[model samples]
Target: MKRTIKATFMAAMVGMSALGAEAADYKQNPFTLVYDGAIAKNEPGKVNIHPVTYRLNGLNIAANVYTPANYDPAKKYPAVVVAHPNGGVKEQVAGLYAQRLAEQGYITVAADAAYQGASEGQPRNVDKPANRIEDIHGMADFISQYAGVDQQRLGLLGICGGGGYSLAAAQTDKRFKALATLSMFNSGRVRRNGYVDSQLETILQRLQQASAARAQESAGGEVLYAGDANLTDEQIAKLPFALYRQGYEYYWKTYAHPNSTFKYTMSSLLDLMRFDATNQIELIDKPLLMIAGSKADSLYMSKEAFPKASGTQDKELFLLDGATHIETYWVPEYVDAAMGKLTTFYARTL
Candidate 1:
């Protein structure tokens, strides 16, 4: 009884109470968000952001346009459409990269995924493979019509899961002059096959649970978690999985709004099983840049896609020596290399 009481006391010290529809303090979990990442909007140059909506596969998508600091609004500039990672927003890495690329003299527009963000969709945060791919093509059309954008010189950059979606998009959309993916994740393959082929044991079980959850949803039950974290030490030890730390130190801690905590229905993985980014990589003929960190577990996904790409001469794969997946998203040294390569690629391709 003494030992039991001691364990309870220790647990209480680290336990946190979560309020619904708000930011979660994850430090207690050691792998979750404890603080916030609130960054002031500083568009270095003549950055004009216009909030717009465009139709994507049946969903009305949200997008933000960044015109360069040097933007005259009177002259056309090369344009890049930046896609966010899975479960991310236009205000995250995609937005930062978009704004910076615009500051570097390109017209950059970053868009949120259909249901999860400040966009229109039903049953929010539903991760559908086809919908995501169609959203990319729709984004191309949207950015091409912006006042200072040159549609013919259009390029697309996808980060994390978005990178894979970009590959799916480029397979059919010929308008994308160049393509780039950062820390690209093969969501579909990972979902169906497990990360690095390690967790196949649970695919069937997970699928079964997802099916049951779908039925419950049809019965009008609110979506919730079946196997998510409860801030237990055991949970933290299990995270930092698949090149992702269980936490968001660099992005969320430095750029998150005090009140913004985004989450998805726990069962969204059901559809994720179908979203493979490398199914037809060989179909993409544009200049392709696949950038990843040598240390990332996801690096293999890019390496796999590179060799299968049809545009061997038009493609390049760059690995940052000691960085991890998230580090490349906003870490200065990593971001610089990414921006530098992007600048050069767009200048030549666009």
Candidate 2:
């Protein structure tokens, strides 16, 4: 009986250990880099990450610039500016892609939006559409002047919500010689109509709530936040959508960072409701390449926006078969596939 009890105890301990490992799946690394393929330590002659800061619209913006191996400032090379997703920081997927592009011999940069991440801003988490688009433009401004970058060959790559804002930024910014978006997420559409348009009838009611939140802020009342609430492991498991479920696992569990949160100010919806990723798309007449997962529920956003870019004489939509939206953020096969296409697209255009 003693032996039997010992075996049972050992079994229970192993099970608990597995649970613990699973629980911390998305937790940050000791060095605090949360994305896969992150730079553990910068090596001088290898692909290196350089943290930078600059002033944009009176705000101090933090960014990470990745330089290719054997980089020479005197020799000009093509560059790509990667925009982070909504509620995402420069250290997340944006950094992942930047590092990858740098490995492919391009100078790449990923930056924190002004009001989020390491950037300085007041009334934090103000995620308006205009601000997001400006963040992309600001990245271009800095990278175009960075050492070793070829201003004439500047490229733009945006992931998720960043993809939408990148579209808007490229519309008027002819400086971007080529543009590509991965898992493009239309924030304005999702904010105004709800994910998958599930809350279409309630749009007016939600708009009213946003207005009230703004009014409360103006009156110096307690500030209200949206999407900042924390969730228990059990609650997260129960989330219905694959994007939310897998996203929670990726962003909150395995690759979590203290500076990253899923929050935005409730009042930002005032401007968001008036925005659309496809607005003025015709103004973007450069090369365009959009990629999304074939199985992604959010695939419609890319499909809807692709055709509207009619002004672009060259545009292509590439889908990663059998992959979901969030999977493209971290899954190796999906990322590799996307990167393969990106290398070809940028090589041809830049």
Candidate 3:
């Protein structure tokens, strides 16, 4: 139980994080997307997925832009920037939602964060809060310049760790007319304080370890990492938290993608420990919508950040009945429910 708790909690700070050994064949997938209902090929007069790349802070960012059916570069359209989860790539749930939103007649883009997935960066999987937040801003920067995107009618959607970072990004990025988060996970809070603050007593001990990791990196020694555990089916099933138990199945088995992994440089904790998603949340004056499963163990994250968004009178905390954290990622019913709310929210606000 102790080992399971440690392994699960370490991987649970973001969206759906887990160790995956097998890589899904991208050759079979033209766009290399692993989500269900993904576009296999582009066709005329139908929703299309365009694989694109752009520069962000000197790193190459890989992204997929979804255009609504009958999309015309000559015609204006609202756009949304979708940020992936902590260990997630652009082809997972982020792609799923981007495609879905495109179907609703909105242009959307889901991008791989720098240092993760296909995006270029050294010491891969460096999941720092600042980088993740900047990734959101970068996506907006790119999409707003796209052919038909209306800069004034832009929206933002962040999932899991991306959600937490979205909150931070939206606080100052007024370009986003509205913002939404699904199954939001406060990565900093979970990293420094532990799941539900379970490891509060070890705060100093962990800080010392993170400090050592930074020292090692500075000295040109071995790079240390966290949240990179390989577990068997039985071990995964034995995980106490549904967020991780199902997450393992989602990222490692069902929706497994080669670029996804629950690992980050240990030195990242130096910045993560002091960060908080809700630190200046009230600065977000745009309309906000935060959705989480009512039964989700991570629901508290959304609830905690919701009230702190006191700057927005148009904020809402909608709960999907009988849904769990991981379930909201792939479950059709929950996805549909979330999409409905998102469509309405963006339509009303954007």
Candidate 4:
């Protein structure tokens, strides 16, 4: 078991190295989007995509704003800010949901988180909770000022790890009137305790390694990273967790994007190890909707976090029967079902 774990980490590092060797051309696609049914070109009478960039904490955040068909800036419209999964770009699942919500007559914006995707940051792919939460707030800030947006009607949808951060952000940032999470993965819990508490015994050891990595950085030593891998089909299939196995196929295969990568600086674990999405979850007093696949190996995350949101009386937990964690990202039937719930939820709440 130890050997297998070591091999997995090594493979991830190899994959990250290869990914870093190539420069990501955000314009590779016509609209720089990788999802299916993405807009090839904007038309006058359809849900149109507008590529946008705005300053967030001195960093340029790359985002896409989708306007509903026949959308007139002269008229007010509800808006939703979609946050992508960890290691995901704005052009993947987030863009898909943004486009779908726009078709539902709501303006939606999806942005690449700082230090990941097309956004500006150093030591790329720094997966810190504070930064991730701030990205959501930044999205809300940008969208609130957009034409035709009703600030009072703002809603939020966070997928995977973003969902956890959204929970943290909405706790104190009450600008969001409604909040929702899909396949929420608690990055802090997983990092500190390992997936499903599998690494509970190594908590101190990992922290020591992170501390050493930070010390090395402070001394101008070689920078180290974690979570990079180049696993083969066999390795991926052998992964113990359904979330990791299917996540490999989704991010590295079917929905691959140049800007998306799993690696983060080893020192980031210092901050990540201490963060918890549910630490102050009760602060979220707004209406909340938490959705997850009944069969998802990671479903426990949402199940655990949902009940902690005691500040809101208006909350619901919806399950997608037979869907896995990754399937909820792109599977047609599951996506449709989730969109239905989201549309209805936003309409009623926002």
Query: Which candidate wins on lDDT?
Result: 3
lDDT of 1 by residue, 1-350 (tens): 32232222211111111111144333332212222231234344556566778887677787878777767767989999898776567766787788778767888888877776777887776666777787788888888887878778899998877888899899879999899998887777766666665557777976887778787787889775322223344433344342433233332344343322334444665776656787877888889998888877678888998888875478899988776676676566777888888888888999
Which residue pairs collide in model 2, if any? 25-254, 26-253, 26-254, 26-255, 26-256, 27-253, 27-254
Alpha carbon lDDT of each predicted model: 0.67, 0.81, 0.89, 0.84
Q: Among all windows of ten consecutive residues in candidate 2, which has the lowest summed lDDT?
A: 10-19
Of 2 and 4, the candidate ranking higher by lDDT = 4
Per-residue alpha-carbon lDDT of candidate 2 for residues 79-167, written as tens digits (9 for 90 to 100)? 99999887777777888899999999999999999889899997898888889889999999999999999999999999988999999
Model 3 misplaced regions, further than 4 Å: 1-6, 17-27
| TM-score per model over all chains | 0.81, 0.91, 0.96, 0.93
Order of all candidates by TM-score, from best down to worst? 3, 4, 2, 1
TM-score of 4: 0.93
Candidate 3's residue-wise lDDT over 181-245, tens digit each? 99999999999988877789988988998999999999999998888788899898887777888
For model 1, state the Cα shift of residue 31 in Å. Answer: 27
Minimal lDDT window, size 10, model 3: 17-26
Candidate 4 structure quality by residue, lDDT tens digits, 1-350: 55456334322211111111223234666887766677889999999999999999999999999999999999999999999887788888889899999999999999999998889998677778899999999999999999999999999999988898899999999899999999887888888887777779998998999999889988989777787667788877797777776666667766678888777888988998899999989999999999888988778899999899999999999999988787787778888999999989999999
Backbone clash pairs in model 4 (N, Cα, C under 3 Å; residues 3+ apart or in different chains), count: 6
Better of 1 and 2 by TM-score: 2
Root-mean-square deviation of Cα positions for candidate 2 versus the true structure, in angstroms: 8.8
lDDT of 2 at 27: 37
Q: Once superposed on the true structure, which residue ranges of model 2 sit more than 4 Å away at CA?
A: 1-31
Question: Model 1 lDDT vs. the true structure?
Answer: 0.67
